[model samples]
Target chain A: MLTAQSTKQFKFINIDRVALIAAAAGLLSTFAAGFVTFKPNRIAAGEAFSLAASVPLQGFLAFLALWILVALLSISGIRLEKQAVFTSICGGSLLLLTFFLAGQYATAATLEHGSISRISPGTGMWIMVFAEVVLLLNAVQRGGERTRFVTALSAATVAGFVFLLLTGHLNDISIMKEYFNRQDRFFSEFKVHLLLATSSVGAATLLGIPLGILALKKKSLDAPTFFTLNILQTIPSLALFGILIPLLAYLSARYSLIREIGVQGIGWAPAVTALTLYSILPIARNTYAGFATVDPGALDAGLGMGMTRTQLLMKVEIPIASPVILNGIRIALVQAIGLTAVAALIGAGGFGVFIFQGLGQAAVDLILLGAIPTILLAVAADGITNWCIAVIQPRGIR
Target chain B: MIELVNVTKEYPGTVAVKDLTFEVGDGEFCVLIGPSGCGKSTTLRMINRLIEATSGTLLIDGTDIRDYRPEELRRKIGYAIQSVGLFPHMTVAQNISVVPGLLKWETSRIDKRVGELLDLFGLDPSAYKGKYPRELSGGEAQRVGVARALAADPSILLMDEPFGALDPITRESLQNEFSRIQRGLKKTIVFVTHDIDEAIRLAARILIMREGELVQYDTPENILTSPGDKFVLEFIGTDRALKRLARLPVQGLMRSALSVVLSDDPGKVEKSLAENSYLWVTDNEGRLKGWLDRKVLDKAPFNMEDSIVRIRVADFAVSPDSTAKEALSKMVLAGTSSAPVVDNTDLLVGEIRLADLLEA
Candidate 1:
């Protein structure tokens, strides 16, 4: 069934079949499942409700408009060669619509049952979220201005959603209720989470970068350093945290100065220490790989041009290796963000408090309150660092 | 001036260069040429102390090279390589000014030097100064590499197959430009290449090396006329006569042309044409306008204002800057024994005869 013209046209169209299939599947499942769940109170299990039963007429119409827009955009993409910008715009619009409808549905449910009823988004809404993400990823693969477009779209979505929250349009939702109940605690936990992630990545960078450079310069150290880091990487996050606790306890007990400085068996000290150890592997590995792959010709030229060893490293090798090194830092940053949530188990005091508490109470909404922001934080970190890497890459190489 | 006496470089398993001796006079363009693994590159590197001589004395300006710090010695010896090895991140001006900047030269001095070097390499300073290496054509980047090497105004230059990566046409043009630049500056240069043709074209003295040893060192003409051994003869190839022609320029052999102005009396023009088969006709500025054939003039009415036998110079003309071989080919293509040579202004300079080219 293949022909030269068909293949040529396919290349020109640049259609992503995976995204198309996912969107179609998501649309089909939306009709088959409940769009939202209604509960009598924050403590009660919710009952599933279809979109027609929950959302207002305007909300439904907006959803329909979004669907039509997505289809039109995709069809136009098939007819044109440059479609990344259009696809990303469509994906961003869909994301905004999904959030708008959820807020509207919550508002509508609250109007009907007042403060007694609690509203939560259902499987249909989650499916749409997954579909939009896949579509955005497809646009990203096409490159060009797509990343910038998507980033702008995400910023707008976050701003609009925050505006709705500030205006108390969705105050009736169970997660919002959970948030209102512990507003001060929630902010403190977010701060702790951010601090834990950043400080650990900072420490990892300080230790790993030098080790990476040394490993590159001294060939004898490369194998042993990588082997140890690889073993550390293979350890489970929780197990690593557990292993750190006793070692820190012994150290704190052995030294009166350590105890005076608040180094203990548990808390931020052990949590940050474990996180830093976990972060070192990615930073070290990427730094080594970056330096190892520098064009040998450039090094030879630098040396032949009378550059001293330090001068060559500073001017030629480091600048060439920086983008790759930053890429490694990006991986470490995102990983550290996710791991900090687990660090809450050691009383490190982050959003993980909500997750564990929700588990004890069997409250899915509380768990989502902790989980959603964590995902968004990781995504934002990834986007920002990827932009940095792209910007710092040498113009000639690019 | 550079002198290497019994210099040797040994690696873990094999000797790279062994017991080499040579002296390059000041302002000489000395080229080291050989097959791969023949130690030509090693010899050049040793001179700059990039690769230290294991057991010998290498002298520059009559001072032993070992007494100077490698970095200090290298800073005084400009180096360029085959890949050009231009810093990808730096602009053309920045790349050219690297050494000057390192030596803490004033900003104005570096800027003026960059402009001068760009102009010297035939690259327009305003157009190419801000461009990155990636934005340049291969030839332009190679020129920038050479410009960067020459930035410090070092008396000695070391080039390693600097034009090896360019296309043949680009390589030929670069060679011509380099020869022009070398004539003006007269820097002491040590060039290394695997190409004998390049060595012959640019080097005042050619040092041909075999595996770890110097096989011959002499002037290009001497090498062509009397190769040191069978290896040297075979390596120069069988086209020695053609190559020797390539070495001679048309300007060196061109003779004054017999030309008559259009304003000259037709009787006098005809008389001049009788001596030669064809006489070149020129305008008031000595530009070649056409030619007068004796046979055609014989049948004409011979009126000054009306009739004359004439053919446009475009039909049979060469440039004064062309090689003698190029002039000979042009003459053969035009089916003429001689052709007029013009300068860039289109003014007739002289004539080139097929016999003169053959004799050269």
Candidate 2:
């Protein structure tokens, strides 16, 4: 009777509706879509395999059991914190288990069919990965200990993947095979990717903050300033990079100063210029908004109390507006990270090298090698900046 | 002393203040009162140079205000406003120490001054010094605003409706507090407000303005009793006499209290009760203890302990500094014809009668 009474309260209590949808989708994909795909060579159409194909019976049962628990936790009448924690743990385990099963089958196939054969994650595996990520992120964001919990979960996931890699468990996976072949090139390209993005964003911030402050100081500059920046942003990153190539080549060819600075037609010079130009709009616009939002009464009182313009800007304006200003940098950073992937097309090497290379050769695993890490890097950068904003924001604003 | 000569502030489309001339003596609590847009606030801002007069010779201590740099002049004149404007990021102590820090005072001096100002405003230093402005109530934040203004102890203060944003109960208590504090510090203050009651309560001299011009300037008593013009007459309101009486402090109107110590002769107390009907009881130190009615003495040879009805000092006594209006209201609320007047320590010093308030 007590159990029945408690179960009835589920309708009235806050239901984890998004979790319900994700878990249901996860279950459907598990039954209908292939667990993995097998190809005799890198470029051939692959054969799909469901769970019963080669997954160990015991391991299969455990995956199903944990998946059901994850779904049940979503609907059960439990404390919110407990629900978040349990769902996250179960969701994380399911992701690792799915990958482990794929890795196991890939190894078995590679030994029989010889090393040139490839095993890429199929539609079902990708859908399952998506569902698990959504559940994990939802749980993390809803919890009170958002930053600390996210950091711990990410660290644990990284450690788990590294343990699998060092033990040769995932060596035969198609993406891992691609990684091993191009390990040195991959590391160099990753370095280039991060350097290009960060340097561009750094330059944008240095210039954009003052531009924003200038717009805020002079009402006449506001429309014209935003107009120019908006136009620059509207130009697609690819098109902007293209435009910079000819313009920089012309300038560097004529001026020794430009050539001395290593400005080039198709290298980091054009890439950095295009990226920095693209980054400035968000920073400048948000800076203007942040400073504009400061209370006018505070400015009046500050001036009335004998603060010089510099003193007011430093002591009163900056501290109060810092959180909003940092938020602009966060936006600029995320944009620059994604755009830097495109820079590899013009000989500025990054993770984009593998993506464009994979596209030319029609190699799905090669594309995954480049694409997955880029996505993760963006998420990590976003998390770090958000944590900064939370830390520095004034208690009064809270 | 500060003087303004032929000061005018003209915008392109309008004149905010025109040909205004006034002198505020040192240590004066001067209030500039009028309806909104009367240029009273503009006039106050000119003294601190927050708003520069279009054409004027503003003098402080026989020196032209323009002789000193604007920031230098403002640093020497403390300023506060209705919004309080305490920095949301700064703690109470940090906010209070801003001016002193600007003036480059020593760290120890600033800390000590901040502590003293916090105590002066009745905010416990240990409890409130580290608290951000958001943590404070409206009344408390306004107290910190005033405290910050006095942090550097400037001789001149420019206040524009410093307590205008508070609820009635809080406003009254803060007003009473500021009045007491000003009586001690006595800065050359030029305060701007639209509230006439506030002017009557705080101002030693009232400057009435209308349409960028002076309507009348005089002491509160004179402004209430005599009309400089029809505008001044209408501005003080129809309850002029009551307000006048309310402005009259109970200290001047009170007579010596008729009372005996707790150990005094009961026969003598009973005898006094026949003539005055009510007799006050006090301790040897003169702190008010109780009261007696002749009816309580109806029992022949009344016991001193039995006949002395216990009275709580808060319920039975009024402060001597309180206006006649406050004493009358207390007497009416307690259903009595008179109330004993006391000092800050609640020592009985005098008596105020309802008849005396009405006659005044």
Candidate 3:
């Protein structure tokens, strides 16, 4: 008999072909595209510079060395399957090096061109960011230990960047300059952004869970309930916010208590309300699907074992369906985080204020000050919820 | 004891069970057998209130089952099904301890009971206790299912085609183990199955149903000999006699064999075989060695001492726990009229003759 062990052959490099292709594309872009653009003033067209010309010689050499090392590892006779932690740490460090070099290049360009010049990361830097994201995703796909390694590595990188910013090492960068100019407002806006996203998701959970259960129990309600939530989702975020504003304004004008509680038409209340409506579809749909897909045999067994309806729901159905439900919550949370950025249009006081101001002035660095953190928040929320789903899920099912 | 009085279960446009009435005495293994959709399963479910009867009275120990809450009633009645339904997320020990835990059994008591039940089902408690259902083989999962059902030591058990999903060989072995467990526990069991042979093998009294109505209700022997109707007779099939033999263990028909020690003097052994035609030789521990034929011995130029003891072949002996049908088949294969019966330890207990089996 030919056993699996006997038939198996060892492979040297275990990296995926797609990852290799992506890495090559990333390295090519650094040589072909501008690493940073330096403008004499915010309104002027900037001069583009290659990665080698933009950063110091040492930083550029370090970047090239890191890329070469990654390329070599991709093809070398060394398997990373068992050494995922090492692979992730190596990949993460490469990402950090790229970011650090980009920041250094921005600072160098600003100082060299005089203080009046503003420097923004260029096409090559964006390509590098995309490549780093792909590499991180690949590490995450390895699952279990690799995912944990990648998550920890990401956290460490973020912490290191924050430390550099606090120590004034990155103050010369245009985005950091924008942050320093409105430091107090930026902090407040960050809090408000979080508050909007969290409260909306919280409200959605409270409403959607019961609706989902009701839809499951009363089959007649399933179609209509889901349709309503789906329609709510289909409406554009701006239009939904538009609708909530006038409705809330009328209610607050008519009721003293509504006004007293700060339920104004153009603030966090309307923003959160719109977001909550948008969040319902994913939350409710996944809950219903998870409950519906529960093993019928297990349900029968639970009922036969004398578990009451509530006990069965709490002990068996909910626990078995948790991972799916949490996945739904993850989708809703990430969506809400991204959508809340638009709430600043309604004076909701979040990072979107800088985004709009940057757009009006055509200031790329100012826009990135808001956009980068918003993207990071979404990614962080997605990762945390995924971890929760993995943790709370019962064994054997996975 | 459980009694169903005029129980009828009606679905939207059909009656699943119609005017069904039956009484199972305490400790009786009552098997409900029928074609699919004959309401046998529906009857079993109605007893546990998994399906409520449209109109009927179900009594357990002379008290109406409806008087108690369904959850409370179910907790008191053990239930198992064809799928086993061992919770995939829970360990075997946890699955077995479900009802006991629900009934507020102390942690230590539930643990002890789980160990005891695992042992009764022939599973090593320590080895199987922590295993999830997915880790278990089909037969082992089914055993755990049964062990779980019996965990709380309920006075009654309801099984719905409990071994229906198993392969033939595993099914037969499980049936034998089930019989042993049933005999030891003596719970008032109401089992449902479509397999007439399985019904005959395990049922003390068999209730045959046809299209939601009772066709026959009697002991296995009576059901085979005097089926109540054409449906009942046809349902039992033409191999009634063979199936009857399946119900009788070899131990029931086995008789004490005329034997001699393996160390017996060859002349005496030959003389004894000469009188009996055949003589069984046993070791000091009473385990069978082999038989000596008088005619073969008489014609042999064999040394008397060397020829006295012969090694027994595997086919020449059957376990006492095996069915008479199994023994008969072995006898036919070995081309012998009789075979020695051994226990689990391979100690010879008695002999079963083909003629004696036919007579029984």
Candidate 4:
């Protein structure tokens, strides 16, 4: 590759490879557990089965492909060892393959419901524990070397545990069963319905960033856009959903397109809509700030160096302002997560399910179940995303 | 080669550069110098199309600057500024390779060029390639800026206070190094500086500007000897005499008529100086030894070389065309009553006293 020299300069020290392998293993195993426990048959029937019997097979296959590519390049003497690109492609593909396999395995497992006794800590469980151990070791050793690594690992570990609990293991075990049986236990069931809410936050990011850019270019649009988001946020979430029900139902019947795009009933539709509306402000504000923060002299330098407008924006301006954009995303993400709990009013089951269920029965255990994970998830998401931002930070930037 | 034709830049309240006209011949080292806000920077920036000219034309090798796009024009002209402006994120090698990379040169060639530049600037290519700007000292970074600007081997180089951020010792050393490098490459250069000393040291021809107007555009010697007006004279300042003497070779000032003094004949110096009030002494090979006073004849037979008041010949002289003001300063600095002025060959000509120099 043309980046061979650059690759050499950025080569992972030999000790880091073990950490990388461990991290990859942990991610693979966590994905497998989610697939297995979330399967309908496994949840309903409660059977003991190895979740990811096929992972070893898939991992071996991936390793083989990577090995072959490296060997071929080395034999040909092309000097094309782009480690970062190579690792990303190989790791990403393996993770994706694992996801596909888990999905298929879960569908099969969920097909036939069994008793709760059928679910035991078996080979799959042991494999997952072992994977976690390796990942933990990697995180402890390599993550200690860098602030970003430590932050990413700590976040991933917390998020991984939450994911594991939501899937089945934490609630299924005898030690934690007392907490689960409480009538008002918020997170009694391992249903992570937060994805629906999180998706809206992502959607908001996609829409808000562009809108903010446009607003920056055209100052006239700023006030109106700001007012609209402000009004959306001002309305109580429950009231907002109550208002959306009639309007959405009418719109849904009138236009099949609205229904097709996943905005159906007042449940997820209103919840997602409310969360998305709440998310726009921070992202928009941050986008404007990011664009405005572009160094004028740097832009001039880019132009002075013969960079086109597009090149200058993409390579110079954006990189320089990326920290601000990342901060905007962070603010939006945290806000959306909190507001998503409010979606429980319209049957949009998030951690808010625990809040509402606990309130109805006056069960503190139930409230703790739902409330704890919700806060943890938001905190974990914030920490991880922030770590990712720090990792990719522009080098020379002040 | 570059020419500024009746160029004038006017702001709301003032003209930044007015009616400036000059041609920098190919391979010439021309410096633009003045105090701050003298429009030297404005003039240099206009060359790269950084600032649009309010009126008149800037021609680079004959083609008007407006004929090309700003980026294209800048790429063809190498530029270095006081701040260095190196991308902090980029490694030393990457920073140096920017223009070449922009031009889409092959990676291997770019690597080779970057290495060559680092070596040329006295930095080890291996040690510095991946290191970012933050790791470099000020002098190293400034040199890197120069290397980066020259990456494309542009025919014309423009610099605005490139070494202004550095300590005096580093700045002067870099100036000398750059001067040495320029002598070989001979790229047409337009250097901007606020220091008149730096201007005289680096420039073959100096353009003195003040209040957005060209004060004088002449050789350092001519500028010092004959200022265009009071402004030019004051701008060059009272130190012009000392500064002008600095430019002259010491060979030009030493006295050629001197009594030869042998190491063995220690007493011969008093006998040789008996007739003349003070005898100019030299070694066996006829190089200057020192000055011997006639009263030394009464003293113990001291070797002429031992008692002689030896002055560094290199430090004692002024160029013949040097202004009387310059010669006087040299005499004062050297603590000599008179100057033993010589031609370029170190052959002593005649003496010029402090009184005569003052009278002139």
Against the true structure, whose TM-score is highest?
3
Task: Give per-residue lDDT, candidate 3, residue B352.
Answer: 94
Q: Write the per-residue lDDT of candidate 1 for residues A1-398, one digit (tens) a residue.
A: 98998887774554556556655855654564577888888778778876666667776666666655565556654532245566566677777677777787787778888876788878877787788777767666664645676556655756766887788876767789889888899999999999999999999999999999899989999999999999998999899989999999999999999999998989999999988998999999999988987777777877888889898888878888899889999999999999999998998978888898888888888998898888888998999999899988877667
Better of 3 and 4 by lDDT: 3
Off by over 4 Å in 2: A1-22, A29-32, A145-154, A239-270, A345-349, B13-15, B256-319, B328-351
lDDT of 3 by residue, B1-360 (tens): 999999999999999999999899999999998999999999999998999999989999999998999999999999899988887778899899899989999999999999999999999999999888889999999999988888899999999999999999999899988998899899999999999889988999999888899888999988887878788878999888878788788988999889988777777777777789787878888877777776676666635555553655467788887888888888898888998888877688889999988887
State the lDDT of candidate 3 residue by residue for A123-232, as single tens digits. 88778767766766666665464566666776686677677778777777778778888899889999999999999999998888888879998999989998888888
Angstrom error of the Cα, residue A41, model 2: value is 0.4
DockQ for each of the predicted structures, in order? 0.47, 0.57, 0.61, 0.27
Docking class of 1: acceptable
Flag the better candidate by TM-score, 1 or 3: 3
Give the candidate number with the greatest lDDT: 2
Candidate 3 wrongly placed segments (more than 4 Å): A1-12, A16-26, A29-33, A81-93, A99-101, A112-114, A132-154, A227-274, A343-349, B258-312, B345-349
Return the top candidate by DockQ: 3
TM-score, cand. 2:
0.86
C-alpha lDDT score of every prediction, in listed order: 0.84, 0.88, 0.84, 0.69
A176-195 per-residue lDDT for model 4 (tens digits):
34244553443433243557
Q: Report how far residue B172 has shifted in candidate 3, in Å.
A: 2.0
Worst lDDT run of 10 residues, candidate 2 chain A, spans: A142-151
lDDT, candidate 2, B248-285, per-residue tens? 99988999888988988877877778888888899999
lDDT of candidate 2 at residue A394, scale 0 to 100: 82
Which runs of model 4 end up more than 4 angstroms from their true locations? A1-197, A207-297, A394-398, B8-20, B34-38, B210-215, B249-297, B301-360
